[model samples]
Every structure is written in structure tokens, then in C-alpha cells.
Target chain A: MNSRKSVEWRKKAGIRAEQGDAAKGDKLQSLGRLEPLEQLESLEPREPLERLEQLESRESLQSVGTLALNVNEQPILVVDGLTLESSSGQKLVEGMSFTLRRGESIGLVGESGSGKSLTLRAVLGLLPRGVQLAAGAVQHTVSSAMVFQDPRGALDPLCPVVKQVAEVVRYRQKKGRREARAEALKLLGLLGLPESLAREDRYPNQLSGGQCQRIVIAIALACRPDILLCDEPTTALDVTMQRQIIDLIATLQQELGFAMIFVTHNLAIAAEMCSRLIVMKQGRVVEEGLALDVLTQPNDPYTQMLIEAVLPLPERAETDAGAEVEKEANERSGAEGQRIAHAEESMPNTVKKSRMEDLKEDSESQAEGGSKS
Target chain B: MSAELQMEQVKVRYGGFTALNHVTLHVPARTTLGLVGESGSGKSTLARAVAGLLVPDEGRMSLGGRPLEKRRSREQRKQIQMIFQNPDASLNPRHSVRRILSEALRFHNMTRGRVQTEQRCLELLERVRLSADSLDKYPHEFSGGQRQRIAIARALSVEPELLIADEPTSALDVSVQRSVLELFREIREELNLTVLFISHDLGVIHAVSDTVAVMRQGELLELAPKEAFFAQPQTNYGRELLAAVPKMPTASGLVR
Candidate 1:
């Protein structure tokens, strides 16, 4: 397929083509047109296509018992009917079930209070004081590692960023400090970050939100565990940075070949990342399926409602009347380099027109009605 | 003042850092105005300042066309009620819904009689779509959406003229979020209350607001009708925010 050639070529080209430099980027863009691989080198990496491939490679269930369990296969982690109850007897989550196979990625998705995080916490034996794992069985292949939402929240303010990552490497792998620090740099590079950040002895406060998240990912990867659990890893990041982190995780999953359980509220993100998606509501699996089918054609009404509420703004409709006004403002504020860096592409025609006409009509509408306070 | 609530050149500062800078917004009698911004943008600061929770560094504020005193009187404080985003966090954990509402009524000296107050509490809960049975229940028993409705009922218990909500549905999921938003709409119309709704979600802003004010970095970027703001945003930041919204493709690879 055309995709195969382009993906192979881009894989060879690597970082040189990933950056938007015209020459290598042009070659990469052409590669994107060939097949599934061609999409990988497009202006933005083809995440959904890559994710779909990963989804298909997941293990089929041998037995359709209440919880997913296969006798012959290695169970990296097994959790059955996990339930958490608060002090007030409020059922945070109940009757949740799932199992992870070796080198598999399973995504846990639900609104807040659906017990997605609690499920992960129960497996790790880390439930909060008021909460208890009232029911369930948690068995795992090996010790697990976790990456939290806020890097600073989990990291010690007194310690340096590299030191925090090194501590994990030293403790879990029993490596020397010097050896751990050296390994940390390699992990940072593998995650596609500059080597300089890995060397910096600065604290998490000094780094940007995206950079801090990278450091958190670095520490999680340092342990070299059989299973990795991430809780809303990209919730705190901007859109562009969010894409970078998701790509990093996907790449590492392929290379390290570790079982993973990703928990997040964003279905769009879940659609583009996970191998198999497990939908939860009031503590039960409402739906479970291949990522694409779950997002595009949800069987459950709750899941469908969740998808519809996303409010996809027209990419290019120009329906937004404020576009021209914003454009003028942007032109004034964003001198050459600034505006070019953040230019909007992938906008649809409907949105483009809607945004343009929205502004044009605003002036006429203002004239019809007197000025508002 | 031209309306029931008016804020001019309001500035809220913590120590040396400015949280709100020269913010001027007016809420006409019984009108709903949506305040939209991301985290650290100071929309919540403005809401708190209006509710008298935080004194502004520089600004004149008035309620009911009367300039507010340097320190609000007990009667004056009751007129502006603030409904917090997280109902579970805001409500007293030990108090039943009945005690929660009655305490507000008694504290404000608005209670007529015990039987009447109990009846009023039931009415308020019913107004927010809760049944009379909900009065005996604790706040922890309800869902995130239901708890939010209870919070709204408590806010209404005071019978305040202005309502300030900071990211009310941000923590709830979509299905619950939509229902909560509809509840707000119903209360706004039925009560003829003036509302100042603050949130970071543009989708929620579009769903609830008539007029929208876009704020960035503690400054107002654009203020316009909801349709106009969505159609043609007037500021660079505003456009960037609009563009940042993710596209929902109807079919995989085929642009909807």
C-alpha cells in the first residue's frame, strides 16, 4: 500500500521531517498520501489511523465471563468487579470489570465520579482515606508505574526535575545515581524532548506545563515496569502540546511493548489513542468496543450524548462573525513569526464561511439595534 | 447606575499581583450575561468581587441603583448570592438539605414560620427539579448533577437579585452537564433573576448565554452577542480559542 512506503520513509527521516521545514516536510507530506503510513507524515501526524492498527492487534477474549480473563495468555493485570465506597456510603464506583493482556493498551473513560481513577487506585492499593475498595480482585503480572495529571503535584518542590526522575530509576531498577541520571537523558530523548531539559537540575515550577508533563512521563518510563497507568495525562496541556504527549505515549507503547491502562474523560482523545475503549457510568461498563466504532457509532444513549456534547466548531465555516475582527486584531498583535506559528488549517468550508459572515453581519446588526451597554 | 448591578473599573489584587484589572461590566435588571475565559483569566475574581466575597482594589460597585457601603450590611449581603461550581464541596456535609436552606432563610431574616419555611424549602427543591423527598437527604447522596441542582436551590433560598456561578458544570460529564444547564435556563426564566455565569467551556457558554464577554489575562478582549462572537470573534486570542476547538468528524477521515 502507498501508506506502507511513506510510513517507512518517514520513520527513516525521523525528527528532520517531523518539524515543519519545507524540504523534508514536503517529502513527508507526499509519503502521507501513499497509505496508512502516508497519513503519519501529514502536516499533523495521522493518530487515528495508527491507533486503529494498535486496536486490531489486541487479544480476543477467550471466555466471555463477567470479567475478561484468558487462562492460557499472560495476565499483565487482572481487576474484577472493583467497587469503591466513600465514608458517607456514597457509591463512587461499582461493578467495574476489565483485564489487561501483555503489551496491550486499554482506555477507561467516564465522566467525573464514574470511578475511573478509583479503579486504577484500587489496583495499586492507593485509595484515599474516606474511600475503600469495597469489592474486587486485583492481580498483576509485575509491579506497576503511574503518571499523574499534575507533574508538580506528585513531584517534590525541593528536588530538581532530573533528580525526581533519577530517584525512580535508582529505586525501582536499583541503578547508581550517575547511571540513573544518564538513563534519564536517554528516556527524555526517546520521548522526543531535547537532551538539555533532561540535564537541567531545575525544579518543576521553572518548566512550562507541557515540559513538566514530559518530565512526569520520563519518571513513569524510568521504572521499566510491565504495566503503566496514566490518569488524565494531557488534561492540563494545550491542544498542540496534547498532540505531542499522545504521540509520545503511542510511540513508547510500541517500542517498550508494555501493557497500559489509560484513564481520561475526553472521548476524542480516547478515540485517537486507545486499543480498546471501556465506557463507564455510575460504576459499570455501559459499553466496550473498538475505539472508532465506540466514538462514531455509540450503542449506548449515555455514550452518544457524551459524543454529541463536544460541540465541533466549524473548522472554516466563517459562521463566527468575530473572525474578521479577530483577524484584524491578530494581524496587529501577531507580527510575522507569531501569527505564522499558530495559523489555523484543517478548517471546513462551513465553519470558514460562518466565521466570516458572522463578523460581516455583526456590523449590519449593530446598525439595526442601538448600542448595547 | 443604569441597572440593578453596575461595576466600573473594578480591580482585584492579591498582595502585589492583580487578579482583576479595570474590569467594567453591568448586568441589567433580570438579564443573564455569560462571562467566558480559561483558568487564571480572572473571570471568577470578577464574580467573587460582585458577590462581596473579595473587596476590589479600585472600582465602584452598586446594587439596585444604590452605591454599596464600604462594608456590606447583613441585609445588603443577602441580596447577592453566589452558587459555586462543585456542589459537593460547597454544601455542608453533615447538614440535611432542609437544614441547609432553612439556615440561609433564618440568617437572612426572610423566614416567615417553620411550616412556611419547610414548605418554601420543598418548593425551592421542586423548582430545581428535585422532589419533596430530597429535603431529608444529605448532599452526598445525590449525583454530581443532582447535587448541583441542590446548590442552585440553596442559592435561590436567599431570593437574591443577582446570581454568580463559576464553571458550574465544568466538573460534570456531558449528559449530566446538559441537564444541569437546562435547569439553569428554567430557573432564569421562571424566577426573572439576573445571572452572571462564568466558565471556560465555550460549548457551555454557547448553550446558556445570550451575550458573551471574552476575557484573557485579566482583561476583556471582546463583548458581543453570542451569535456574533461565535460567528466572527474580534480579537486574536478569541480567534485562536475558536480555532483550538477540536473538530468532530461525522465519519473517519471524511470532514463533517
Candidate 2:
């Protein structure tokens, strides 16, 4: 159960010959060891696993347990020999497998049609209607929640975002309506959406794409997930917003100590967010390893190609001009860093941007008070 | 000479919300102006305003130094063509590629007859890197990248002097985006068409733009030559935006 130990489960696995030790990645578990999703649905929940969660944290439904055990070394999610096919039996994902350890983040990297997303869907037991689990198993014991790629589409247009988050908090956490709303606002605020935005009963359409995404994550957080499945959650966002969301998630993960499986096509982002990288190519695991090793010394040509394809930002000369820009970027963030600093981490730029809106409202309210006086 | 797109103090409003607030921009002749901003930053509003899809409340727009009339002539309309992000929405599902390209060609009076129109359609297909045989296919038959190419071909079919590509490659996959961007570069050079390429990705902007325009909250924060802007953006917000782009850890010179 060592964190870096490679469990050589399946001898006949396709891509594990180079994975073990060299890449520091676990070999894909073969068939028959874990239960498939369909069978697990009807089967009674595991007694000790349910007791493990219940025993660990019951002071509040949202509270996570102190990880006193050597839990980080144990696998939390095992996608062992999973194969997905269409209703027409056309193979979409073939023999895909990976193990995610508790509090250890792994990234699924691949372009379109590479089955990276389908593998995530299989883990969540929410594969699309046409797709079916053709073989293998998903052995996840704890509860999980997913943050979708398109925030707008994932949300209900009719529901106010606060109400939407409260609904999940109330349903899953079984809280009172007022308490649920309060919790939702607190969660949203931690995600850097201030009370001015989160407290207002705003629908998904009224909010920006970035705001809606934060609310979506708030709802997912309300589930108190032990495993967070993010499917290209920042793909539709602008670069700045994407950075904010990635920072928010990373901070939340640190506080909550949850394992995450992040699926994205951007290798740079994957390297930034994850410690381990699993490269998928045409429905198979092409390479899996420590993120830096996979990125720096790729064993697969496709992985190497993906690293090459990452379009770098325009190179900056670290002269007086570059220093000036760095200063300017930091100076803007420092303006309101104190007010919003407590609840956030690594959110200097975005917190300032959002606080500008708060300050605008604050000045208007003060003006109204003066007029009344 | 390729036409330069000029917007002087252009303002667009949706009731109380001022989408584009007195924004001034100039896309030089035959050059691509990368309009970069987050959502609700009025990048699309500026695009729609220039394409004459929406009227700006108060502004002057001149195409190649000629003031543009609100009610443009058919030729004037043909001079500016727009390609939207989603090809599925813009390209009619019912029409074949041939019919779509031919309709535009016939409307612009760019082709002499039916045979010439067909010839022109094939050339447009080749221009966008699609096979000439793709002319017979429907939008749904092609992959997303191919469909985007078809959309680009349709935009080119009219022989427009200015191409307004609003997030043309954003809907595409990362691998596909590069090839499509190369097509945009090639077409711009070959036709000398002024391009207003709007995107949210700075990487995409760095790839295609000669001049970069950073917009936020209905204002143009900074507009500079890509080299100058990238090295040291004048505005603090622009610098923040530049800092936000993810730098690959293991890439030779990149470290965040």
C-alpha cells in the first residue's frame, strides 16, 4: 500500500511493461478482481466501507475525517480492466484501467475520441445512453461527484444558482432550508464568489460562465465527495478564469484531502494539477507516470507529440519591462488581498477582480446612506 | 490593397448594459487583430457591430478609409463575412456543401455561371484544406474540424475583403485548432484579407495575432504589437491575463 508502489495486478496488461518503477505508475488491474458498475448497483453497499465513512465523520455530514491511518497509500478508486462499447457493440474504450490512491490526484490526458472522458464516466457510473460497460469493473468505495465541462449546460436554467446549490446541500446533507442556503453561500464564497454575487438569487444565465462554474463546484462540494471527478471543467473558460478555477480546486483539495481524477486534453494543465499522468491514445493507456517524468521523459511517441503540441505563451525577456509587468500584476492583486485573503489561497488576482464589483456596490450603498442622512 | 477595419469610439448597448463602451480599434490592412477577453467582455459585441449584425449607438466605422453606411450596399455586405464559433449553428444542416458555397458565390456575383460556381466551390474547399470531394457532403457527415473548415470555406466563398472570425477554432479540439489556425494564416496571406480573429486563449492569440487587443468590461485595456504586449503588457489587468495562461513545467524554457 505504499504511495509509489506499483501493484503488478495483471501480467497480461498491455502498457504496464514500461510503467512499473520507471514511470512509478500502477499497472492496470485485470478482470474479475473488481465488481462492474451494473452488478454493484443492485448489490448491497459494502458494510465496512459504509461504516468507515460513517465512523470517520458524523459530527456533520459535510465534515471530513482526520486521516490518522496510512490512507494516502491505499487505492480509493480502481478502474480495473474496464471496457466500454456502444449499443451497437463498437468499442469506445478498450481495456482501460487505473488506480487512484486516497488524497493522490491523477490526470487523464488525451485528445478527442481517446476515451479519457468515457473512462471517467465509467467511474461515475454515468456513461451516456448509447455507451455500455462491456467488461471489467469500477471499484470505488466512497461517494463521488463530478464537475462537468460546460457549466451552463450542467446547470438548470430556471433555478437560481444559490437555490440550486442549496438543493444539493439539503438533499444530500439533509439540512434545513435556511442552513443549506447558508452553507451554499459559505462554499461559494470560499470559491471566491463573494456574498454580493452568491447571496443574490441569481440564475445561471445572469451569472458569467466562471460564476456558474463556481456554483457548480459548490454543489459538487456539498456532496462531500471523497473523490472529485472533473471532466475538463475549465475548458470553456477564459485563461484567467481557468487559472482561478484550477487554483480554487487545488486549494479545496488541500483543505478537504480528497483524491481527484482530472480528465483534460491540455498536458500543461494536467501537469500543473496532478502528480501522476495517464496518457490515453485511441481507447488505450499509452503511458502512465509521475507527471514530471511523463512530461520530461515520455516513453510513448503520442505522449511526446502531445507535449510538443502545447502552444507556449510568448517568451518574456526578464529585463526591466518584464519586472515591471510582474510588479503590475502583483500590485493589482494586493489592493484587496487582505479583505478576501482568509477564505482563499492562491487567488490574489481573481479575488481582487471580484472585489472591484463588491467595492462598486459598497460605494453605491455608502452614497445612499449619505443621502438618507 | 486589403481593406483595414476601423472602429472609432464605437458603443453598443443592450438596454442598461453597455456591451461595447466607446471602444476604438484598427485592424491594419491584411493583418489579423486578435481580440482577446473573458466572456461578457464585449469582444463578440464588437464583432457583431463590425459585421453590421447590430448597429452601434454612436461611432464611426470606415473600411479602407471609406466611411461605412449603416444600410450597406449588397457589395458592401459581401465585403465583410463572419464565421461563428459553432459551425453546426451557422452551416445549415439541410444544405450540401456545394449548395451552401454556390449560394454565397451566386449572391456575391463572384462566379460567371453554374459551372464557374462549381469550380469556385472546389477551390474554396481546397483553400480550407478539405478535399474537393467534400463538396458533395453535408455538415453532419464531416468531423468537427472538417465542419469548421467547411464553415471557413463558406466564409471565403464570397471573396470577402475582411474576414471576421469570432472564435473560429475555439469549438475545435486542441490538435485540430493548430491546423485550422495555419489555414487562417495561409488564407490571409493568399487573399490579403484583413482578419479580426477573436479568441479567449492567449496561446491561440500568440499563434495568430500580429497586433493583440486585450478587452474587459466593454473597454479595450491594451492594444499593442504582439511582441511588445507579450514582453511587457502596459496595463495591470493585461499583465494579470498574461500570467494566467498555464506554463508547462517541463517544457524547455517554461516554468510557472
Candidate 3:
């Protein structure tokens, strides 16, 4: 524990963590444009008068922040003393508080029923029926969208995938059919889905689990959401497919520059994509710190247990450092390029096959080079 | 009391689609054989074939050098037990844990009278580290991890020689998964049972398996001792699968 290298590493981490997200506010802008409250109000169903009428003043106050909030200067969300209770007065989430800076990513890491998902749902204003906010406030300046755990279940089976995305574009953006469809296609393409499938009109049933998830991401993006809420989004996918989805989401966040609140039970994932990590257990914050500090020098027993529980990465096949990972990147990009080039002739099948092969190749090689057994 | 499980060129086809394409594998007695593959790669189908849940179109499966027939005899059926992925789906919601465990014991004639069956059910619960109070609770009353334990308990009720677990811990949290994997390992050693453990997570497979098997598109790619397979896979496809696992960021930022 007293090694010189360890001390230097800890010192370096301390300096990095204290830097804060304040420096990155300048170049960041949400891919989804900000819309006025009145503009979004008209997009709501006319028959939802009863629901809109029931809107609490607290919600309106938050919306006001959404307007006065500038992407460059202010924090996107500030949740203060948030408490959640079930219908029978059982406290579900206790005194949760965190600030999500503009265009920065924060992860809420915990085990299931740890209230991480509940907290994310509360922020998105979509808590399951009977669970209400008991105390405190969730105030955000920008509107958000969400990606769910089960991709296929989140989508409509009866509708074509492209139509489903375009519908969200139509409603949220108030764009006409041609413009909306074009926007939807652009979003899909951004998520690494092929451009050709827009013409074929593939249904959810026809696409692979990974492709369907990309479509779901496209739907979320179509809203032009300033912040993205993701809840165990890749749990249902195959590992390689899960990797692809994670990579795709990270890339999108980079290109679009949206703020993110990613909730996951896996600490390894949280470490990869998040700058600040909040470790929650049993509806309470157990540990909150910079992701590097939390991963490398965990203070809480629960956080320590989670870090240990992650399966160690098997050794890579190539002994020379970084070559395998570099090759993996090259293969993925090459295959993705190949996928886009040959996408139209056999839209659904070809895309799935090529992507699977690409992922399978890396993992297969990884498994070979990995575990000492 | 346990025996090896062997599958020889087992082939299963549903309509025109070949679910198991001339695949062959073996789980040595008193050892675990871990199965890894992506979805639609026919790993589950192969498990079903070995369990006698579905009749394979071709090839043979044998337990301890004896043929495991397409339609197994009652004794043969009792020798191999299968655990499904979703405990909620596998366990009857309306039935109490006591009823579920007792039913399996009685079906295999593990005990005679009600008192004896109830006694055996309690033992099954104890084997999986659940308290006696859990006997009266329904599956829904238990958490995801506890429910999976109940599933494991029921699978062990018949004292099967070969255990088929299909992604049993995939539904559980990591901390819970660690305990379940431990229980499985302990049980395998104590009973000398041959286990066909399937999971997409290589970390898990690494923890339990004496040997590893890879399958893709219904075809077996490679089979080797866990060390050799992970160290230097014979086939290119096998190496690629190893490469595909999401690397856990290790301590000191040195994780693969």
C-alpha cells in the first residue's frame, strides 16, 4: 500500500478528479435542438387535457429552468434532497442528490432494486404507477429521452421500424412527412444502422436484437433530447452485441455532445462511459466520487464487492501490447463499412450476419488469449 | 452415483432449419463442461437434445456408457435434470416452495409418505442455503437471486447425475451470482455430478469449467481443457469468441 508508484497514481487521480466538468462546456451541444415549452405543449395529445390539467406547479418550475437554461453555462440537471415513496408510504429512494453537468456523463451504479433505476425513472418523469416523489426536487434545464432494457419489448411489433422512429420525429420536432422521414433515417444512420433498410420497411420481428436496439436509440435521438437516460440498455443482448451497443452509444454521445445519466448494475461499464460515478445500495447512495477513484480506490464495502465480482478480463492472444485492440477496432470499422456498402440487396440478413461475424471474431480471439484457466 | 454425459454427432432440425448440426461433446464424470455461444447459435437446442426434452434427428447420447433413448425410461429421465434460465417461468407462481420441491421428490419416488417427502423438501432447501421459512413462500415473494436458488433446489430434488443449467445466473446481480456459482461448484464436487453449465459470460465459465466448448451456427468449433482453450485455442473461431467478451476494467487500469 505504501509503494511509490501507487502514491504517484493516487496523486494523479486526485488532481484529475478535482478538475471538474466546468472546462468542457464550450464546444458541447446536444444533437437534439432545444424547443420551447409551448411548442412541446401543442405536441401533446388534445385528449390528455385531464392529465395536463393535473400537472403540479413543481413540474412547471422545472420546465422554466429548461427555457432559461443555457447549454454553455449552467448545469443541465440539479436533483436536490430527492426522496421517493411507494403508495403505502414505504420509502423507495432516500435523499438522493447529484448534479449532471452540461454534456458530461454520470453513471448511477448499483445492484437491482438498489433504487438506481427508480431514480433514473424519477428524473425522466416516468415512475411506475403508485410510486411518487415523497420529498425534494428534480430540476433540469433540458428535455430528456430514455433507452430501456428490453429493446424488442420497448418497440411496437406491428409497426415498421422506420415508421416508429419517424413518428417520434414527427410529434416531437413538428416536421412534415418528408423532412421527418429524412431526419429519422439520418438518426438511424448515425447509430450505425444501414441506409438501405429505410426503403425495405423492416419490422421489429425481422431485425436482430442488436439492430432493434439501434432502432430504439434512433427513436430516442429523434426527439433531439438534450440528455439521454439509459437503464440497463444492453442486459438482454449477447456480449458482443452488448459491446457494439455500448460502443455505438459512446460514439453518438461524442458526435452529438448530449449530457447523459447512465444507470447500470455493472461497475465495469460505468467506469468506461462515466466521468462521475454514484454507487447506490438499497435506495441510498453508498459511495459517490470520480469514476477512477471509485474503481481504483473504493471506500465502501458494497462498492468493493461489486468491483471484485466483475469477471477479470482474460489475457489477450497477442502478447505485444495494444495490437489486438487496434486490430479489433480496425476489423469493426472495416466490417461496418462493408455492411453499409452491401446493405440494400438483402437488407436485414446481411447486416446482422456481417456484424455478428465481426464481433464474434474479436471475442473468439479474446477467449483464446484470455483466461489462464 | 454420478456418470459422464456424451453426445455423438447429435443433429436436431426443426422443419428445414438445422438447430444442431452434427455436434459432438462430452462431460467427464465429476467435472463441469462449460458451453459458450451467442444467441441463435444452437447452444440451447443442444442442451435440449441432451436432456431428452426434444428428440434429435440423428446421432446418439449416452450416460455412463448406456444409451439415453429418444424417449427415456422413467429411471433414465430421473438421472438427468435441467434448470431453465427464468426461474419465474420455471417455478409455478401459485405453488408454494414446499409444494414445488415435494412434487419433484414424489414424482421420482424419492420418498413415500407426506412426512418423508416434507422432510426431503427441507433438506433440498438446506442444500441451496435457503431457510425453512422459504418453504411457505411463493416464487413471486422471493428476489431474483433467491428464485434461482429455488430452481437449483428443484433440479437437485431428483438427485440427477448430470445437471443442465442454461444461463441460471444471468438474471442475478453480480454479488448474488457469485454465491450461486459457489453453490454450484460445491454441489458438483460433493455429489461428483457431471455438469453442463452454459453461460455467455466467460468469467463465469472460467470459474466453474474443467473444460470449455464453443458452438456457432449449430456446429461445434473447438473443445479443450480450460487452460489450453483460453491460452491457445486450436481454432481461429474459438479465439475470436474469447476476444469478444467485454473486458472488465481491472485495478491499476491494467484490465484487458
Candidate 4:
């Protein structure tokens, strides 16, 4: 607390910095980047409609209105005052009420062990051992299927993907193997997977995680279910793959008109993908509203915490890392704002250039570090 | 066999498939180094190699700055501890929390008698933010977050200086993950333990790591000061990785 002690603490921090403590150094370094994150503080949160504008503006040919094709028909699966309990008589989910209309999407966001997954499993009548739907009418128009997070673990390793997909058609539609096989290829293609995978008599081991997940989606769609349950399906995937899978699911919902109950802990993914959102905490729904509204103006403190945790590094941070060594050298501008503006103007191409430069720099650094050691 | 561990040009191979190629890493006394990479990037392999579970074909490994024995001795093996990806699988099904945590302490000769072992275990449990009542319960009785705390307790029971955690919180929900990461942070500071945190999640790596080494396809891509890695990513892989993160539009008046 004294002046000498404060000076000692500062000296210790400097020594730690010299000793290569990145947490200390990064705290000292982030002063500049915090400028932008702070700039965010002054800017008003844009309406979801405005966010939608960016997406829509990017794709004029994409049918936005058609996305709501089967939005408000009827409750495809209505849970009327649902209450679930474990065999030990402990209540899990209570008084849960929701209507998932055909082609509409609903996200169930919650913390771990909050009974979000159990609520979805109750609809599928696939509750884990000793857990049952005590009181609920989980009405469904047609068959319902689940897409899980771990594609590698979800699918049977011994069977080919086509066989797995075809099995669903056979079980649900009573189709013959030959007919199901033909349909399986079509479904896989529809799910944005290659038809060549159908020809490969190889097992799940032959496929990548992304391809395996696509196969899982194909199987989920094989039954042509009016409602589909996706249980943290994209949680295990990388960001780019997660984006592609989300887009794929959205496309499938538009084309097939299957209602989706997307259960996940990721509020950002839920915000980007779902139209309606239900925020859950400790087995109770804390908030429920349109996804955009809830994400933008969340009433619940838990929901706010969830939203704040989904931090994303800005685009400029990624592209401005001197990865584009050539750009840094060749395009010399005096002012910081001008450089950033010019970079923004050539943003698309700059990203590619930066990436290439970064790769080169990484390899060079590895080589240098290796030799030095 | 020494109490420390080192990797010199460690290259892992499965027949012709190379999981790690010429990767050199060092863990000095009482210092944590965080290893990060995408899937299939050999972080797990690196962990396994250090744990003596996997032998690198073309590299030398040493403990306490001395060359490792042709085979790890029991004492040498017990000095290194690993916390795996999933707590669900790592803990035994039949054991109670007390039995599980105490067993590690007894196995490593850290405690002598049952009462002493229980005392040590309880202290560890308390340090990890678990109640004394939890000692009598089974692993399945605890939440995923609690189970991870127990896992950390078990890892610390042996008094190992170096801790290698492979995606410890990847299975957990985000809020639970924050709590568990906080636990790791506390343990690192309290024990001055050297930690090799292996994860695919950049957010997690950034939150806890002092230095981060990025790996790709059995190769060490970039190792930088955590600030340098994030502030000015020098590799294309790192750039694309940063770009792949979905940006939350800055409140243009609200973070809402």
C-alpha cells in the first residue's frame, strides 16, 4: 500500500514481462485494440433487422421471404404444460410450454445440467435411464429424429454412411433396401455432401467429422420428419464448419419445411440461426422471445452473461496482423485512419493476402526457432 | 529418471503417418506452457508423448534435463500426471470421490495412512471448491463442472509439478467452463505448477495461457508470446483462425 511497495510491485511486473509472461505483456499490449472494443461501447446496438440487412444485402438472389415458407401453419409439436422427473422423484423440467410450427426454428439456450437436452429427449421419447416424461403431450405430426454434436461417436463405425442413412428410410418409410439406397444418395446430395461418398463402401472411419455430420443430417432428413431436433449439433465443429452447417440447416429448413428445436449453450450461434429463443437456467425457462430481440435486449442477467461470453475477435484484428508483409511495405500510408480505411476498402482481397503472408511467416518462424533451439 | 520432463525434436509416427514432426518443447521448473491447435494437430500426441504413453520414434526425451531411460521407471512415470479430454471417462465408475482422490495420493506415496489420505483429499477437494459432503458421492452424482474439479483434484493429489490438460473444458457448457478455467488459474498460481494446456478453443487458450504454441498437421506452426500471437499473428493459419471467429458487431449505442 505504501509508495515503496507500489514501486516494488511495478518492478516485479516489469521483471515478469521480461521473463516472458504473456498475460502481463498482452494486458499492456491490448491498450490499442481496446480502442475498437471501446468504440463499440459508444455505438448503439443495431436492430436484428439491421443485422438481417447485412446478410440479405450480401445475397439478393437468395430467397429471404421463402425462408418463412412454413412459419405459422400450426403447432407441429406442442408440449402442453410439460413436466419431467427423474426416477428418484427429483423434478427436472417443469411447466415447459412451447409450440414448434413447421419450418420454424426454436433455440433452447441453457447452462449445463439445466434439462435443456432432457426436454428435447422427452419429445423424442429418448430420455436417459430412469428419466421419464411424467406429464406432457409431446404431439408430433410425423417422425422425429435427433442430430447430435459428436458425429464420430453418433454414427456406427462399422457401417457405411449410406447404409446408416438408408436404415432410417427403411425403418420409418418401410422402403426396400434398393429403394432406400437410391434415396440415401439423394438425401446426402441434398445435405450438400458428395454422391461419391455413397459409392465408397467404406465405414465411418473413412469420413471426416464434417462429412460424418452431413451424413447424420441426411439420416435425420431421411424420415422426412415434420420436426427435427438438433442437440448441440454444431458444438464440436470449427467456426467455418459451424457456419457451413448452420447455413446448411437453414437451407434444409427452407427447402424441406421441417420444424427445428435447436438445443445449444451457444447464444451467438442461436442468435444467428434461430428465429425464436428460449433461455433456460437450472431447468427453468428464464426468458423467451424472438431470437433477435432476446439477443439484442435480453432481460435476464444470466442471458446477458451468456451473450457477453461469446467474444469474437474483430475482422481488422485478424487482417491487420502484418500477415500481409507486402501490403505493409508496399502500401505506405502515414495516417493510421487512412491505412485502416484503405484496408477496409480492399478488405476482401486483403484477407487473402494477409493469410498467405501469415503462412509464410509462420513457417519461417518455426524454422528459425528450431535452429536457434 | 528425473522429476522434470523435456522433448527434443520429438516426432511421432504411425507407420508412414506422422502425427508430430521434429517438435521441440521444454518445461522448466515451475512454469506452465500452453499448447494449442485445431483437431488432428498433434497436441494430444504431444501430451501422450510426454506422459510416456506414446514413444516418439525419432526424438530424444529427458526428465530433469537428463536423457530418459529406455523405459520409464515406476517412480519416473508417477512424477508426470495427465488430465485427459473427458472427465466422464477418466474417473472410475465404481469409486467414490473420496476413494478416487485418496487413491492417487496413496499411489504416489504422498500420504501414509487412510486418515491422512482422507485429510489430504479433503484439503484438495476444498481447494478445488467442492464441499466436504461431496467426498461420499459418486462421479456421476456431480455435475460436469464438479467432475472436472474432482479431476483437477486427482491430478494435483500426486503433487506433480507439470500438469498436461487436453481439452479439459471442451465438453462443458460455457459458464461451467469459465468456473473450471478459474479453478485451473487458481491451481497454477497456488502450486506454481507447470501446465501444458492443450485445446482447440482459442478463447480458452487465450484466457489462461502465458505463451501459446499453435500446431498444424503434426507440425509446430507458431509459438509466440500470447500477446504477440493475438496482437500480430505471424502465420497464415493463425490469421485465418482469428478471422474465422464470428465478430459480434460492436454496439453502434448498445452491446445489447
- Model 2 TM-score is 0.82
Candidate 3 docks at the CAPRI level of acceptable
Each prediction's DockQ against the real complex = 0.17, 0.41, 0.33, 0.18
Global fold similarity of model 3 (TM-score): 0.81
lDDT for each residue of candidate 4 in B97-148, tens digit (9 for 90 to 100): 9899988777678898888988998899899999999989999998888898
- Model 2 spans > 4 angstroms off: A1-72, A197-199, A325-373, B251-254
Give one digit per residue, the lDDT tens place, for model 1 in A1-373: 7655643443333222111233433433343222222333342422434444544555552111012223477666778887789989889888777888766677788887777888877766667789987777777646566778876786666667777666665544556779877766766666666667754578878777777888888877665545678899987664556666777787666545556788988776666556578988877889997666777789999788778767554344454454556586678777765444323212222354676675666554545444531
Cα lDDT tens digits, model 2, B1-256, are 5899898999999999999999988888989899998888999999999999999999999898888768988988988999999998999999999998899888778889889999888888877878888878899999898998888898888888899999988888878888888888888889999999999989889998899999999999999999998987887788788889887875353377
Distance from true position, residue A309, model 2, in Å?
2.7
The whole-model lDDT of each prediction reads 0.71, 0.79, 0.78, 0.72
> How many residue-pair clashes does candidate 2 contain?
0
For model 1, how does the per-residue alpha-carbon lDDT over B1-256 read when each residue is reduced to its tens digit? 1136788898889898888889887777877788876666789888888888888889899988877656998867877888897888999989999999899998887878899899889889888888899889998898888898888888888888788888898767677888988898888887778888987767778788878888877888888878778777777667666655544445534231
What TM-scores do the predictions have? 0.69, 0.82, 0.81, 0.74
lDDT by residue for model 4 over A1-373, one digit each (tens)? Answer: 5754644553442232121234423432332111122342342321223333454566432212123433345666788778888899888998898987655678899987788998888887777899877786677654467787789887777667787777665544456789877767777777778767766755887877778889888876654555678999888886556767887887666544556788988886676567788998877889998766787778999998888776443234444446465476456554676667545444444344567775676566556656976
Off-target runs (Cα >4 Å) in candidate 1 are A1-105, A112-115, A118-144, A149-153, A157-160, A178-214, A225-227, A234-260, A309-316, A319-373, B1-4, B252-256
Better of 1 and 4 by lDDT: 4
